[model samples]
Target: MKKTILILLLHSSLSWAQMQPFPLQEVKLTAGVFKNAQEVDLKYMLALNPDKLLAPYLIDSDLPLKAERYGNWESSGLDGHIGGHYLSALAMMYASTGNPEMKSRLEYMVSELARCQAKNGNGYVGGIPNGKVFWERIHKGDIDGSTFGLNNTWVPLYNIHKLFAGLRDAYQIAGNQEAKNILIGLGDWFLELIKPLSNEQVQQVLRTEHGGMNEVFADLYIITNESKYLAAAQRLSHQSILKPLLAKEDKLTGLHANTQIPKVIGFEKIAKLTNNADWSGAAQYFWQNVTQTRSVAFGGNSFREHFNPIDDFNKMLVSNQGPETCNSFNMLRLSMALFLDKNDVSYLDFYERTLYNHILSSQHPEKGGFVYFTPIRPNHYRVYSQPETSMWCCVGSGLENHTKYGELIYSHTHNDVFVNLFIPSELNWQEKGIQIIQNTNFPYINTTELVMKLPKNQSFSLNIRYPKWAESAKVTVNGKIQKINKKPSEYISLDRKWRNGDKISIEFGMKTRLEYLPDGSNWAAFVRGPIVLAAKTSTEDLRGLFADDSRMGHETKGKLFPINKAYALVDESGNYLSKLKPIDNLNFTLDSLHLQPFFDLHDARYQMYFQTFTKEEYEKQKDIQKQTEEALMALEARTVDKINCGEQQPEVDHNYIGEQSNSGYDEEQFWRNTRSFISYQLLNKDQRGTYIEISSLDDFKTENLEITINGISIEVFSNNSKTIRLKLPKAEQISLKIRVMSNYTTPRFTEIRIISNE
Candidate 1:
């Protein structure tokens, strides 16, 4: 029966003529950086207590508790999210390495979840806090959602989507039949829950970050050959996001980056399964815009969790938030889906770049902690999560990022094999009766050799990618060079009969180049092949290197170093590459700095981007930058507590709650406005702050708004000024509220700061 089910899945998967990635069980990671990362991730996964992760599910099901729920995000509104990610990581790791511990843990988790579902009595199982009540509200059409919350709960749909994805991965990747049953049960529950809602109401619910609901439902349809699951997938795909992409419009600016990327992945999945050309085109357009116009050299996008203006990346360069790990995690997923669907080698370029630079560098090599942010602001550091304390969204994605490095190393069709990345690995293509051993020390060594071991002579094509960054790529068979000229972003196919001892080798030359920001800014990053290079600047003042359980512990809270103090390339000859002297194949020396692969640099402040200028422009630019940095530092010294109004993490950290409120970005600043009321609770830190300041992007009429402190009305000192300052009460914690006096919406508040008079 198991073999029959596998055959059926394979038949259904080939309904579309797309490249398919080999199962993780077939591609084994050899000795390399990726293998080391996998081992480290496994250790971190073992460090987490399963009972703590399962506590919320048990509590929701009214089962006897074995352990307390984990703190941080687990105890916070987003309870049980990491447990879902843990399920995926365990399944993939078990498939990749066949580790007995991983399989045992996976089976344990699935069984416990099965128990939870049975106890719920409605085929429902989730770790979301008060999930029963939350879904009931949605079932009754009592929907209210923002960018990160739904029905007064913190992204309960997104939280539950993780479980759905986990169960799907468990069944599909690890061959757990029980997990599949649970997934279908949950899917049916969701289908019935939204049966009474209108299309408009579903779209309203999609406003929150719900992960890839459409993609999971589509997987369910593929698994069961059911029509309802397909319809549910279509209904869950947010039309507001899809319409703009379908029309080839980039309405992505100012939107949350990670939330939209997963939806596009779902778009590609549905397009492939149903053969929808328009949706396929929309997904392609989105991938092009994000990769070509919005991404940094490291292949990560966004600033402060929102997509910044494509024409200007200055805000991203200056802010400590930089590109988030979750954005890159989802981008890689979208890239892989598009690459398989279109057989495009260009998509592999981004997948390889992000895998090497961002994903590989996100985890600590020895400490086994996961990074939330990879800051590009020169001299700024990143904070990694502790297994027991940290539970951020990035932590959830980071846990799975390193466990699946073997996913896209190679892809294939019926009679052809495609080498997508240069990572060292061994592939056993069971259906094709072939085994290939790929050996390389890639990025450090510029050549990879593959040896074929087959039962007999086989006639098939071996397609190897010619990377966009590799110059003068060469392919050789059994030490004999083959003349096949191809440009970058294309594949060179070797079509012939292959024997047991046949060998194929690929060699390429890498040249260092200065890649400027996508915004065409003066700032530049160093890249050689697909590897991003950086220099460690300082070891001092690396505060919060390992995160605690605090709400904002994932962010680097150290003092910001002045931008003018960072190293720059000031050359009058318009030749910046001349400054870099090669120390070795993967290391370089630039004046007093030693640069190496970004994945190798850790535990210190580093600079990935450096400002470039001519000799004549350096001094003047330095002075301007110094003044701006000084003013920003002074404000930090005066601020007791502050919140960026429309940003997701900041608002969520401050316990934001509102009704009839909306948030957006304008003039490169985030703002929130409301017709009803919006409130946030901020800390004053020992009653040192005497004044509360509210700043808006637009002028506001004082007569049309009511400002309150702790439910007490406060007088605004400025009538129509962009800045409003009011006296604060003598309390350490202040509840700030802004409401419209009549029917008019309040001004777009950009920031709220607690000020100290001293």
Candidate 2:
């Protein structure tokens, strides 16, 4: 009877999906690198104070506060965002490990949030600052939105989406009934809130970043089997993004990378629930485009949180900010959805690469802190978040990344079991009266063994994945090798599986190879099987290794080693792998440096990519590269403050306010143009800057423009040049404004830099 009830619950939770992952409670991690990561993440999660995370929800709901809100992002404009993520992390960890403390924390959070909902009396509860007022204005159809702000609030929809996701996880994964009730109430409130607004208004609101709102509503539909929730999910989908995707256009360049990935995940989810092949095809096209053209060898995409042009990764190669952790966090979700819905082994290949290279490398092994960015620039470092002082989006996602490593290790149907990842784990199939223990030290050693325990002889197929990176594989049952006929990216199935203590072993060999950048660039990365190989360069200047509670603390604000000075591979023949000498199975020696798996090399400056050139080409280009690097470094050194005009985070950080304004990307630059006015607050600390330089993608010679410094008119030094300089006012803080003087719109401004004349 107990097993029957459990099966019923599992069926109820996964009625809509074509393929289903086993419940977290039924899978357990054994002694391995991934298991260690899970333990480390649990420690980090416990270090965060639950009371502080709940402060925003309490204060906003007019309830008594138990603790002050944490600083950094939690107290800043994006208040209470991490609190939602914490609930999810807690619930997933509880389900994955069956830890009592995690369950207690999850229950506490759900109950507190329930109180907040009850106090609001309108079924609305959130951690967004002044959320009540913000929703009231949104409900009244007074909407003003930009790329990262709606009604002058920083991604309120994105912030609230975290809460919605957290509540769903609590109810579905942890079996918390109260959470389901609270989720229904919040979903109803959201439905009513948008009922009065037109579809156009909803689209305008969606211009800002909102994390997977449509996906959560679809999940609500699955939970309640209600048509209204399904309708809401369809209504909430962004038409602007959907239209271009359905047309199979690559309109993703220069867009925020993490923002779009979650929405695409929602697209796949809704597609499955409604059986819409068009939508599913669109999502699949997006996945192929991003994974094949835009991504680095490490399986992470974008630079500085935005998708760079696929043909040129030069900007990403030079910038200190590289692939963000949040992008990988969402991409993995999309990959899992597609892999399950399509039953494609190709998706699993990408998933395994990213899981080993990017996701596992994102967290500190011993420090128990989360990383926000994993810069690919040679010799550059990353900054980790301190539990008390950091609340970045990556931190929120990072909390969940390591906790659920057991999610895709094994999946099953009623009569078949699929072995997906090679991580050491055990699966309990209670309904079938079977237990499978999988043990491996993969990548370290290239073999995995599975021991099956069954009460009676049973006949079922065991499908083992054949990764694309492996050239050949051999499978042995008991003691004899079985005939192999499957190719790469196809499953090798054993037809008969039975009896207790039945053992199966799979062995494969990995070879070192070079993977060039997707843009066909000269830069190349070393890969062995699915693991990316990196070399530690130096540990001279790893500034802000651990973050403090500052707005940009998540970024590594350290001296950038000159790109020209970085180590390069120079050879006349195109045999880069010949340069690598094997020290062991996983370690190699290249010249004077030692290379190992990227996930194991931490707390030091490392190089994941190397510029490759022929001997003659290297001799000829070295001098020119040095000159360019010097000039770029000099410009960076002289800057006191800077802002990329049209990007989301940069503009929001500068307190941007505009009327009759719009932004776009053109000719490899992001720009903003205004017919009325656009203003920003910039800092010239210690009054060190002598001039402010404004750059535009388009020439400003034909337009009438009025520029002001702290509300005072300033003379532009040049009107014909693409860049104009103005004398800086003698103030620490300057309010700079650009106004259109004629009927024509202003030039497309790309960047504003406060230059020091010292």
- TM-scores for all candidates? 0.97, 0.96
Per-residue alpha-carbon lDDT of candidate 2 for residues 216-316, written as tens digits (9 for 90 to 100): 99899889988788788888888888888999998999998888999899999888777688999989999999999999998999988899999999999
Clashing pairs in 2: none
In model 2, which regions exceed 4 Å deviation? 1-18, 701-706, 741-744
Looking at candidate 1, what is the lDDT of residue 111?
94
- The 10-residue segment of model 2 with minimum total lDDT is 1-10
lDDT: which candidate is best? Answer: 1
> For residues 1-758, could you state the per-residue lDDT of candidate 1 as single tens digits?
00111123213445233578999999999988999999999999999988898899998999998899999999989999999999999999999999999999999999999999999999899888888888898999998787877755888888999999999999999999999999999999998899999999999999999999999998998898887887889899999899999999988888988889989999988887777879989999999999899999888899888898899998788888989999999999999988877777889999999999999999999888998888889999999999999999998898899889989999987678989888889999998899999999998989999999999999998989999998888889999999986888888889999999899999998999999998888999999989999999998888899999998899998988888899999999989999999988989999999999999999999999998999889988888888998998888889999999988889989989998888887887889988898999999999999898889998878888888999999998755479889999999989998888898988899999998978
**Model 1 TM-score (2 dp):** 0.97
